[model samples]
Target: MNAIADEAIYSFGIDIGGTFTDVILHRGSDGQSISTKVLTTHLDPREGAIIGVRQLLEQWPIPPRQVGRVVHATTLFTNALIERKGVPTALVTTAGFADSLEIGTERKFDLYDINIEKPAPLVPRELRFEVEERLNARGEVVTALSQETLAAVVARLVEQRIESVAVVFLHSYLNPVHERLAAEYIRKHAPGVHVTTSYDVAPEIREYERTSTTTACAFVKPLAEGYLRGLQNNLRELNIGAPMFLMLSNGGLTHLEEVLKNPIQMLESGPAAGALSSAFFGKLDGYPDLLGFDMGGTTAKLCLVEQGAPMLAYAFEAGRTKRFMEGSGLPIKISTVELIEIGAGGGSIARANSLGLLNVGPDSAGSEPGPVCYGRGGDQPTVTDANLQLGYLNPDFFAGGSMQIDAPLAGHAIGRLADQLGLSLVKAASGIHILVSEAMASAARVHIAEHGRDPRHYSLLLTGGGGPVHGYCVGRKLGVKRLICPPSPGVASAWGLLVAPVKIDRVRTLQTTVQDGDLQAVEQSFLELEQEARGVVQESAVQHQKTFVKRLAEGRYKGQGFSLIVPVPDAALGNEQGRQALIEAFENEYRRKFSRAPSNLKIELVAIRLSVHTEDLIEEGLQFPSRSGALAAVKQVRKAWFEETGGYVDTTVYNRDLLGSGDTFNGPALVEDAGSTLVVGPNATCSVTAHGSIIIELH
Candidate 1:
């Protein structure tokens, strides 16, 4: 491979998704970027990323040695937990609490159904061992840990050949003495096994969530370690001497070492990157409030971004038995960018149900046997096949002509479904397309409503491989007046990693009534959290820069079960003015969420959160190459389906790369690029911005 100048410096961002691996190589000096996508190797995800990286380096003729930093995000850890492919693990909890995971707050996701199933615990009762340990809610030891019992438990674990163990004790979040002692003994006796402690993973009050999160970390620890180490060694073999960083589920980048300790923090890493991409690109194009819509092969994710920041939630569920049901999954207590995911994507299988109604998926044909249109041995018809039948995708120009697709194969598969539904080909295909879009739109509506936001007020920012292909219909369903499709929408998540800031989030649970709380102690606690968070962020930073810290607290009425998060002032809370400010902040947030605050209830503080980060690395803004030349001609005219046209109509097709800034086109058109395609419906006006993004305004 050819090499660029020795002085040139570059950064690499790789995102491995369910169906594709996206790689972007960015030149730091001038903000130039080149990206590519390749089918993910399910057997080994790293192999696909390495292949994509090699292709970009060779195609751009840039030396691997000049690459300054490498940032990556993947769904491997989450997939391992969902598929139950991780190492055999065991949970160790306080005596008499071995069935806590099974009991699970005794709540049912479906209350009315007589036959309801909850997700099984990761650790079976046979493997779960308990020890004599007790700590009160005030962090006072009620009963000291019994060394004899713990020793016996350790021996059983080693004898059973367990690969990993989780040490969890009641009230460990308040005082981790027993948990730490147990972990130390286990590590000393079983040197070959991995250990995860609830205190270290999640220092929160919820026992079920903490135990679940800890066991999850233990289950995926060995796999993540091996994968990360193998990837580092592979990069070195390719002569890319760069520091590696990982994107977290909270839309921040951290060093690999931090991630190895708590791999559960990366549960939503890939989708978080897509949300950040929407915020970044949306803000650049003069829109701050937006609804991020990312549709890939297996799933579609929707997140809300307001004022250039995505919403964040402190807890998330994984591997849900019911895709839309909230409590049908494992609870993980990690801070994550709030997102609503629906099983509506390009690869979602479509079929006729027993009741003679058409049904799309909550299941998908992943990259292994992708969509039928790819000719990859898939016989079931998918949304991609329906789109291909509807003329939304160009067979000859798909994936920039890098991968050839068979339209006839897609037609045959979709035709079978049409025959089952007793509908014409065009109507059947359109029904599938519209069905998936409606699913996404319906989910987005509920998500937005929950956040107290209106769909019409927010512009829809579309990304991912399938996002642009179906964005027009999805946007119209939500009543959005505008849609923003950024450059290289297919690989936008990878690009998001490059532009993300080094960030860390830290939290501690401190239960106290606000009216009688120790204000000085709370202030001291915030300082300590800030110090810890800053240390981590500093370790991830390459150079010294201005650091920013945000303080937030979760509070609720004294007798309530849950709390609401509110921003805390930067001033000292010991004084009357500061105390009053804190009270008002909670009241205002409470009113905003519930329409009113309780008149006679005292507010109790539950947790304090700190967010630390360095300024964005790209302050000068991303600059796209100025396409100042004359507007190029349309590539071809093809028959494309549109409801307004009543059938397939001869539509204008333009090469995206050939369209310059200020080029305007009225739709019943297709704009084809290497990574994805933008289908513009009739009466919609499309314009190319100076940043090379397509802005579509609908009537």
Candidate 2:
């Protein structure tokens, strides 16, 4: 293998998930990513990444030297926070605000509960130290930061053996001088300790969440940087000399240098890939509003895509003790690709509850000791066991038979669960599948409703290792009519990396009111935002690109504590009429959200946002000859359980690679591939597309 050249080309996109590492290779000439998957090496995720890349290279007969850019998405940051595996860290704040994490928003989400525990602070109270400093909301400093107090805090941190420190001062979002000075003083005294500032990292309102976000950034900075550096070195050693780009939770890519400073931005990186895939493929299916459904080994993720773009969120909570409960986790405000996740995947463990009713997971038998069917020393019953016992899986053909599964183990696990629940083995397996499907449907419903949407109105784009197997049941429960399972669905997320546009979102808080007639202030904010966003995109190293800007204001009627986001005109700040038009747009959006506009209420603006984008849009889906025949005529048949039918049905099974366009088949079918499976049940019809995808229409 030699280093890749400018003229030659294979590009790679790698997604390192909890259970698997998927690799997609693009042929330089066609720019089509070839996909494949490998079991994750939890001990060293990079090992699986390399193996997956090598496997794809071998199959395609492409030299390593031909490979160009490598886009990567990893769960390292998320895992570190979840497992508490990052380096020793401490927090420094204003004299009176040292307990920001402890004295959070102060509003209990579960107000009626007698005992509701809040999420534990990431940095312990003992390690939190404060310096005498105060900054007003308008960037005015009342008490200057003192060097003597900073030195004492550094001395104590050294004594406590803290390797990383985060500084967050009161109202620092408006004036960062105190936080920056404190960081410099600490760096001078504790030369080896990493220093992070809330002003530099988050610079937002909400003292507790801002501090937590900065602390988390510092907490995982060292670990993520080391891992990324190692991965880059390994790629260089393999002669794949393309610059590596990391996927952000916001569905954008950033260079390794930028990612190292803010690893928390990559929290939802892996799941974002799947959402991108759904959005990209759904467009080709003539569906602009699609609900992405991804069910893998450990969890089921749902994301909404409207007009071929996935929704974005500015606030996210991670490491929740209670999965669906708000305020059960630490809040970190940043631009994130919106998604809803549940514990309802193939490896989700199933067990009997105290009430004697069977329940499916929020817990999973992950990769190492996977489903009992994997014959990997796992004894617990999981969704995989239910699928296998119900004959949804072909024992020897799972993962293209890369690892043989033990049917006896699957049967035993399901049977044991059945015995405890006083049900037949078949009934218990079907029950598990239904329970999991309902859980998924319910989660999607809540997520969609939160955005004031109806699930039944959107088309479902299903992908992942387990999505196809349960998509129909989940869709049925949600009352969704159509399900689209694209080709190579298992590696769909990796493919998504190829289609994502270079995007940058910039936001700054600018509290003002239209009544104030301070248009220059708004203009200045947009100017600053534009410069900042352009700087980030330039840092990404994508050259010779055009920039498009979308100006938006977070506005609300007077007296409202929070603001609703409204898009403003790009030309608004330049003239008076443009400002009037922008205000009208705001009112229109407000009316849409609230269903009416208050006649006499004043309006206030809280924040201004600008997003820049550059994309090489390509036509989707290559047309191929359609196959005309019953799907069963071209593939094998297997038995799969149907909850609605209350019995097993003989289901036609086809290999995704072999299915061609225009091939149609009725429900009670399974489509198999190396990476995943698609299960179509009774009352459904599946038709193959020219690009080798399956469109399942539900009745």
- Assess each prediction's global lDDT (C-alpha) against the native: 0.89, 0.81
Cα lDDT tens digits for candidate 1, 382-484: 9989988888898988888888899899999889998999998888899899999999999999999887889999999889999999999999999999999
Per-residue alpha-carbon lDDT of model 2 for 308-417, expressed as tens digits?
Answer: 98998888998887788898898987888999998778889999999999989888888888899888889999998888888787878788778788999789989999
| Candidate 2 similarity to native, TM-score | 0.95
Assess candidate 2 and give its lDDT: 0.81
TM-score of each: 0.97, 0.95
Error of 2 at 610 (Å): 1.9
- Candidate 1, lDDT over the whole model: 0.89
Candidate 2 Cα outliers beyond 4 Å, as residue runs: 1-8, 616-633
